[model samples]
Target chain A: MKFGFLMREIGQGLSRNVSMIVSIILVTFLSLTFVGTAGLLQAQIGQMKTYWYDKAQVAIYLCTDTSPADACPQGEASSDVKATVEAALKDAALTPFVERYYFEDHQAAYDKFQEQFADNAVAKYVKKEQLNETYWVKVKDPNKSAVIVESFTGVAGVEEVRDQRSYLDQIFSILNAASIAAVGIAAIMLASAVLLISTTIRLSAFSRRREIGIMRLVGASNFYIQLPFILEGVVAATIGSVLASGAVVAIVVFFVQGYLAQRLPLTSFVGVDDALLLMPLIIGSGVVLAAIASGFAIRRYLKI
Target chain B: MISFSNVTKQHKGAPKPALDAVSLEIERGDFVFLVGASGSGKSTLLRLMLREEIASRGDLFVLGQNLVTIPSRKVPALRRKMGVVFQDFRLLPNKTVFQNVAFSLEVIGKSSAYIADAVPEVLRLVGLEEKADRLPNELSGGEQQRVALARAIVNKPDLLLADEPTGNLDPATSAGIVSLLEKINQNGTTIVMATHDVGIVDRLKRRVIELRGGVIVRDDKKSGYETALPITDQVPISSDTEPEQGNEPEQANEPEQGNEPESRISSTDQAEEQE
Candidate 1:
């Protein structure tokens, strides 16, 4: 209630426990930075998932002369076999799951193979007739590729049904593990921050026990005595929060944007806007936790 | 005003109650002296009056509010109407006299304008106006106790409780502090002072309530310490025999009286020791 007096007391308390306060700030900063990093990593993972899953397709390979004899018992897929596969893709039963499907004949496949191996010597020996034709089917939902795979597998002309998501799944699992590790580290750091903040508050209260005793005798309410100590923790943690937000923003700007985004142009990365969005959450949590820790810690000294 | 009806205070882990079946009434504008030896419950009585400790049995009332069942949240409001001083004169060592006195007002959320005026006025009353900027360590024992006194009364409380406030002062200096208390009491602040100083009690001849072994041995209207001493000269007895058995060791260890010179030297040393 007494703003000036509380401010003066907070200032004095912070100054008296300068070393403790600084450690609280540093710990809060480190912990909240990890929190932001974890959040940003999850966001980036989500972005990449959206980008890759949207482009993911189920490729059904048709039998060719060079295909394994077990898959192509007739030695090669005839025109009628290609026609049957195309009709199955357009069937009314599969319409809901299929977004679109394109036929890549042996000629188109050979052209892509040649371009892919333009610098290799084998590009000249591979003939168009030997390459298997593929039906590239993009599904509405990537996870729904199971329906399309079940439909074409072991079919008369199909050699293999391949979902591109299988490859992307490996990448995502690695990123997910990274995100989880960041969160685990953030959790540990935050716990340390809470303990450190409470210790700092306890030490401050101990050093000012005489003042607190006098205040209690003079009819100062519990809230009146605790506000300054709570504010001391809040102020230090807020500075840490701001610094963490700044670090998160810089990470997005420099590492995500300038480095990762530049080097890995195909994959989407978390941006500055995402980091800015996380600032409030990071700072809010820091302030709330610090206030609670200090508030609870100072209660032992305010028995009267 | 404070009233205790058959009040009993039993502290945890103690062999006997701190106060047993004590009843007394202190009206508004009365300066009452609670004189007792160590562990005789004088401080406990004062503490109960301030609501710092609750009576284990019987009803206790202060300023017309029942202290037994009063909600803890309302305790601060009750305390604001009273001031308390201790034997140690607990002044913040870093603060100057002005700041130390102003601190009481500040704690109760008084405006700076009121504090600026009231602090100097109270310091002037305690004869510390010139030493407003001096730290607690820089001041003498008498001056430090006066600052504590000034801080206690700065809020203009309805009652003042002093628990052995002059215990650490010399005879002459304790006289000065008592006179200051008398001046404050004259201004209509009910004062309840707990003390072991027989010299002050003998000199003042105030309303003395003496306790021995958790029970009142004497209550006199305008009586000196000699009139209150007949119970101690003979074998101490209690309405119940149990407490009398516990009083033997306490009575035997009672500090010898008429040792004002030694006490005066220790008072100065204690003041310096705090620094």
Candidate 2:
């Protein structure tokens, strides 16, 4: 049989069964949307991880003259103590873990505090002599910041050790939860798409039963009888995929880019370019899904 | 050629066999009529020949293929050598006459070039060349039947089985359909028609096998056929001058000697004598 003839029959079958075709398209579109959205969310989470992890540093502040008794055993950390803390960070044993380290003396600390709190009353009270000196350490692996923080927590001159990853971990936990939920929804919707496409093909076959019977009498092969229905399913899925990709791109650009980008540029959400990058994946999934669903339906219902 | 040796068919959940130990043979180029009342297994016998229903017991062969042992996958290939017509004329509603006829060729993977030549030739054979573009709905009952006939014979099947081909047509139209079938048979295609149209059967004067109560009680082949009016006409011929009178008296005298029941004897005896 000519492939063109098979395709024409598939086109006719789809057109005649318009309601079934639409149902298949809608189910496929919804399923692929959830799938594509999950992918975009994962990409966004990855972007955020890279952005926050790269800048995440451990901030160790030395006790200052204004530090509470809990913070410091005597008065402010002396120049000798601060110098000792800076030298300890440069030790050869920790060299591989630490990328680089910077020290802020009392004057520099005071100036940084004034810059951060220009409108606060605390800025007037904080003089150069009363400020705390600190060493900020950038590590090669932000994920292992806890090891470095523990190393410095009880060191001679360190007043406090903090790893920024702990704070970001809470946000990533929420993103991970959301990603799991998205995957679950996508799986359910994909199953629905398969079922709907199968039912649609079944109904199409039912309506064409007479034609099929006649074809069988004329020595038509089973494959020839089923080709049109399989093609119908694939076409519906392909259209659904195209529509879903368009919707995903529109959502990413108009919503993520236009609104979220302006409001929280620092969050580093996925843009249209990133969602569009997954177009091939989305379309591939759609075609495979349609073909599989139709193949199974044809096998079960059309026995030649 | 078709042959049945003690073929038996028992449908699912049925108390009795649809066909019971039926043994018959139809030669090539012979136009045979299978006559029976409803539930007498006329349709069942036809279905068996098409392999739509397999014999429950015994051997059945068509075109030298053992239908009883043939696999379902190869049934279509076997059917290509046969043309079957149904009472309902199962044409695809969406297809035009040309497409419907062309479909037979299409299914067999005939090239477009052959389809173009063959479809029109078959349409012309059925005398429906002008109605090629018309859908089944647009054609009259007789025209639709002709389209179906065209489709059946388009591939030039070796045998034609028509089950009630003119069941829904008028008497005049029924005769015309039978003549068409006869014409095809004359051209070397064997025809087996199952009909309740006694008028056409009697008029054709071909081989007639009368079935009653799921058995072939009679088989006949002759010319100068006796035409029976339709049941609705209510014009019963007197039994004294009936063509079957001679056989009826002899069968009546020895009713207990034959396996056939007395109620089925007269028709079967006349049919047997014709054969």
Candidate 3:
């Protein structure tokens, strides 16, 4: 048969089973919505990981004049000790891992502490004489910061060394778990959608058994008879995916950007622009899901 | 041309065979009528010829294809060489008369140029050129049957197997259908009609094969009416030269006396017997 004839038949078949088509569309839309949501969450989590980890720094505190430990028993680090610590940081062995280092004296630390706690009662206790000088070091790899921290710990005149990634690591563990759960739910819903589509197509075929029989007797090839039904399923699924992507975009814009961006500005969650960036991925996934579901469904039920 | 040797068909779950150890041959260009009461396997015989049902034990050949062993995938190619008509007229309700007729040619991948020319020609042959645009529901019973006939013969199949094509029509309409079938046969398309319409059989005076309980009880080339009795008398007369009423039941029952009817036989029967 001609391609035009096949298309016309597919069009007529879809129109004739309009109610079934609509049902398929609704099922596919809801399923793909979950799938898209899971995808966007994963992307957002990755983005947050990149943003927080890249700027993370290791803070090394130097003993001040009131310190109790022998490392700084004189209650202040001598100029020679400070020079030794700075020279050790700049050694050729550590140069590749260390990006840059900046030193803060007691007066600068006291001012920064007071500025951070300006509204709190702690601001009174954070006096100029009690604050310790510190060195803030940036590293090339946040994941490898433990090695550098261990090297700096217990060094002469070094009171403490801590990487800021521990807090971010906890948050990322939760996000990773949630992403896995979302993917699991999406997979289950996807299977259900495929089964529902296959059943719908089977029912459509059963309803038209007489027509199929006639076509068979008339020497129609197996492909010729099956193409229209398969195309019908695919068309319904494509429409559903498009609807789902639109829903995702709308939800991201109205809820995530407009509401959450204003309400929780500090968390650095998904922005409307980021969601828009996922448009190609969302649409591509939808098409692939629909095509696979429709292809397998036709193969199972419409075999000649 | 068709031939069957010791053909027997036993349907699944049935106690008896549908066709029991029967042998028959139909020559090319001959119009034959298969007549039997319901449950006597007339339809089964027609189906066997069409390869719709395979024989349980036999060698059957239609148009030189060994039907018992032909693969299912090749059935369509074999069916394309023959036309079939059904009692229900099996016309697609949504298709126009023109499309219905054109569908036959479409299956064989005929070019649009050929279809455009061939479809109208076939419709005109069936005298339905004016009703080309109308759907099957818009046509009457007889007209629908004619459309089916147009579809069946459009490809000029080698044989036509019609199973009760006129069973639902009125007597006059039925006669018209029989005449159309005859006209097609005269133009050299072999026809095998399965019907219980005795009036048509007696009136048309064609070769008739009568079946009873899955056996060919009577095969006759010449049968004349015993006008002294009612027209319902069902008897087999083998000789065209013999008078209609003089043959006794005892003589008709003689077994294995194949030499008695040599003079009345045709050259076709002689050739068949030689084979």
- Give the top-scoring candidate (lDDT): 1
Residue pairs with colliding backbones in model 1 are: none
Clashing pairs in 3: A65-A75
Interface RMSD of 3: 2.5
Highest-TM-score candidate = 1
lDDT of 2 by residue, B36-135 (tens): 6567689999989988788999999999999999987888888889998887899988889999988878877888899899989888888899989999
Ranking by lDDT: 1, 2, 3
Docking quality band of candidate 1, CAPRI definitions: medium
| Candidate 1 off by > 4 Å | A68-75, A122-125, B231-253, B256-275
Number of the candidate with higher DockQ, 1 or 2: 1
All candidates: DockQ: 0.71, 0.45, 0.23
**Clashes per candidate (backbone, < 3 Å):** 0, 4, 1
Q: CA RMSD for every model?
A: 4.1, 7.8, 9.2
Best-to-worst DockQ order: 1, 2, 3
lDDT tens digits by residue: candidate 2, A13-34:
9888998899888888888888
Q: On residues A1-304, what C-alpha lDDT tens digit does candidate 1 reach at each position? A: 7788988999999999999999999989998999899899889878888988899999999998889988889877888988988888889999999999999998999999999999999999999998889999999888789999999999988899999999989988987898889888989988988889889998999989999888888989988988999999999999999999999999999999999889988767888899999999999999999998888888765677
The alpha-carbon lDDT assigned to residue A221 of candidate 2 equals 73
Q: Tens digits of per-residue lDDT for model 1 on B1-275?
A: 78899999999999889999888999999988987667778888988888889999999999989999898888899999998888889999999999999998899899999999999999999999999999999988989999999999998999999988887777668878988999999999999998766667656778988787778877888876556435544534443434543444334225534345456455445434433
Q: RMSD of candidate 2 to the true fold?
A: 7.8
